[model samples]
Target: MTDWNGAALEKIAAAEELDLAPERPNGTLRDPVTMWMVRAGHRPYVRSVKGSDGPWYRGTQSR
Candidate 1:
């Protein structure tokens, strides 16, 4: 697995939003979903404001 460097983490944290395109079971990418992200210490995290019922969140579970 790839690890995040300090610079990359800073860049992502600086952004107000990010786009996530989750892969489907068939290996095709779903539509990009705009999401809010945060840098927690050395790790990055994201969540669906719409909660678990959000379409984007559900799509991620498929992968």
Candidate 2:
């Protein structure tokens, strides 16, 4: 899809499409958080911590 001026309109369409993506429930952007952690002397490896009292908390849970 090209504009009236014969310019390639691919960039404009892609930007609008990204804006309609699903929302994140964390109330903050994940990408920025990951990047900041990387720059702040944090290790690249990560893991999840949870309580085992509930039935959902199993020892074999996977990321």
Query: Model 1 residue 37 lDDT?
Result: 90
Give me the displacement of residue 37 in model 2, in angstroms.
Answer: 10
Candidate 2 contains a number of clashing pairs equal to: 0
lDDT of 1 by residue, 1-63 (tens): 356899999989998788888777789988887788987788888887666899987766775
C-alpha TM-score for every candidate: 0.74, 0.16
Badly placed stretches (over 4 Å) of model 2 are 1-43, 51-63
What is the C-alpha lDDT profile of model 2 across 1-63, one tens digit per residue? Answer: 222222333333223222222224656533311111111122122222223442223422532
Report lDDT (Cα) of residue 24, candidate 2: 45
lDDT of 2: 0.26
Candidate 1 TM-score over all chains jointly: 0.74
lDDT of each: 0.81, 0.26
Return the top candidate by TM-score.
1
The segments of candidate 1 whose C-alpha lies over 4 angstroms from its true place after superposition are 1-3, 60-63
Model 2 residue 16 CA deviation (Å) reads: 39
